[model samples]
Target: MSEYDDDFAEQGQAVYEALLARTGEAAPQPRLEPTRRVLDLLGDPQRAFPIIHLTGTNGKTSTSRLIESILRAYGLRTGLFTSPHLVSFNERIVLDGEPISNEALARNWDDIRPYVEMVDAELAEAGNEPLTFFEVLTVLAYASFADAPIDVGVIEVGMGGEWDSTNVADAQIAVFTPIDLDHVARLGSTIAEIARTKAGIIKPAATVVTAAQHPDALAEIRKAAERDEAVVIAQDVDFELTADHVAVGGQVISVRGRAGEYTDLYLPLYGDHQGQNAAVAIAVVETFLGDGSQPLGNDPLVEGLSEVTSPGRLQLVGIEPTVLVDAAHNPHGARSLAAALDKYFDFAETVFVLGVLGDKDAEGILSVLAPIAARIHITASSSSRSIPVDELAERAAAITVPGLVHAFDSAEDAVFAAREWANEGTSRLVVVTGSVVLAGEILDLAEAEEWKKA
Candidate 1:
């Protein structure tokens, strides 16, 4: 196992251990008290840096990464906080373009530990429970960002935006990547309801930028923005991705937009969805800089878009059998993945290793990929919300297709089984997706094996 200096490791370990002990305290009720308490105890460190709060069912993570990179390119110290780290917990906290170092973790944990303890004691006395996993991590992220002296921080909501812990920060700018019908049981059952939940992140007079496609979702967001007196900029109305030209081994992309036409805009991500995301990022920069009475120039905009890279979105891990991983946990994301897969890959047949959370529409995701996949291997993710393996298999079987279908107890086993089928000396493709949690666990196992090789 990798080892660090005992002192630093001890501090980091303490933070996680405390969090572990507090898990399963109670099902999270929609309350903002825990987040507000943490912020108050820390002197509201979130306000120390200007923030761009992003929330949506899908595209939020990619959009946040794009904005952070663009801001950093404009020569600002940028902090990016996202969730469900693909490989390590450190991936959730990035300063500039790098993950938080062990030194940073040690320092931030030491600073926040006292406040966390105080909150724990207060909760106990009040007959309340300790902070949840996401709440504590939210506090840590804000503390780390403030300590880094970041000029700007892009925060992605971990779940529904309204009462989510990250909502404590009143964003100078609020960006909605696109709202859809996922997390229905928690957020609400309709797109409008989901959009309303996300729109709660907006604060008074904050500038709102969105790529929300559904008219109902946009209307709800516009309503919230109007109520809060926030400025709302919708993608189709305010900006657009006119065209995109990507070259071989080239990170630069050529795009034309409503603001102005720019060439060689470099973004180190794949898919046409990225082209749309780039437009939103540009609008955010314009919103922030334009508020200063001096509009942002094309030079900074170009530089910013050119430097953004989000890992695990069609992330290519190896050649020969061609392993790719994406966190397409919902129908919106699944459709995007299917589009990208169709555009970039052409195999004789395709094999899919799929698993999903219980709360997800497993059938919907399976339907999206049904046309392209030659075989489907269903399995359960390593999360508490994972759908039962047998249940997922039954759902997949119900989907009509000529493709072969099977099920397994775990993602690791399903992946291995799919790998064997794909490596049968034919031109077959393998895709592992369905849930972010599943993707993370699969990636973790792959990296563990890779480390063993080294």
Candidate 2:
């Protein structure tokens, strides 16, 4: 566990692990009342600071982190909470640009355990299930943020917005990345419905920043913003990636924000989509800091975005084999990842290491990657819901060219095989993707081995 699990605070990692074992998003909490009750028990800590709330199918975490980094650069003490942590549970609650310490995490949980147990007992008496894993984590994050007394909280919803556990707190600025047809079975079948569900965080008179979205998604978001009387700033209309070019380690892009045009900004990230993400983040911060009237000066904005890093999104993990790890689970995300791979790297042969959850559109994801991948190594992630490697390999073969699919029972073996294939002097690149779980597992392996990129 790399001292993550070892230095388990006074309570040890066992209790936290037990908490993690609870029902996850697979079992939905239909209402936000349970989370509200828990927060009420904890003295409504979400009210302790202002929040910049964000939600979407993909890029929510990235956008949220960017916003946090920018706000921190502006001298705001920050509390950031993003979901489905790549490697550590501690990643979900970051303060001042660092994940909450293990001691603090355990102590915060201990401080709230009695209150949570009280609520659990009350719910049991009422014949209803207790607060869930995410619900508890949300509570813990809110409490921890309050304890930190941060100047701002950048919160990303755990799931759909309206009823998400994190929605108990009203967002002063509601930001959305691209809304797509992910989690359709849970959110809704149609893009409009999903957008409506995500629009739940837009409070009255809030400033809303949204990425360029599908016509239907845009319509839904517009309707929500109008209903709330929010001042809306959308991509392509209110802001844009005016120009971008690939630099040595990242990209440089200029965005015309809601308030003013900022030029010659350096973003140390990949993809035009990330530049687009930078635009949305800039607009959100403009709305918050500039009141949509005047842009913040260039120095802070430049440094903030330049220093921003989104782990597991088009990240280079190792070299010689040239391993890349990205958590692009859905078709939309996969397409973006594929395009970024094409743009940022030159590989004679690219082998994709893929794993997918059973709930995702595995076929769609594979189809998107098929155009770019020379071969695919299918593997299962740590998720219990992951599609079997053999099944994924079979599906990938159907979508990809014949005889280019291989299956590994675990992500580790899959990575080993991909690296071996790359090492055969084929100018090869290995990309580990298809699910965040797989990315997390592979990244942990890379860190353990101290693999350096070529």
Give the best candidate by TM-score. Answer: 2
Please report the TM-score between candidate 1 and the true structure: 0.92
Which candidate should be chosen as best, given lDDT against the real structure? Answer: 2
Off by over 4 Å in 1: 1-10, 24-27, 249-258, 292-303, 448-454
lDDT of 2 by residue, 287-403 (tens): 888688887888899889988999999998998778989999999999899889889888888989989999999999988887777778889998999998778788887777787
Q: Give every collision pair in model 2.
A: none
Cα shift from native, residue 228, model 1 (Å): 1.2
Give residue 404's error in model 2 in angstroms.
1.2
lDDT computed for candidate 1:
0.79
Candidate 2 lDDT (Cα, 0 to 1):
0.88
Candidates in order have lDDT scores of 0.79, 0.88
Candidate 2 Cα misplacement greater than 4 A, ranges:
1-12
lDDT of 1 by residue, 349-405 (tens): 878788888778888898888877888888877777788899888878888464468
What is the TM-score (0 to 1) of candidate 2? 0.97
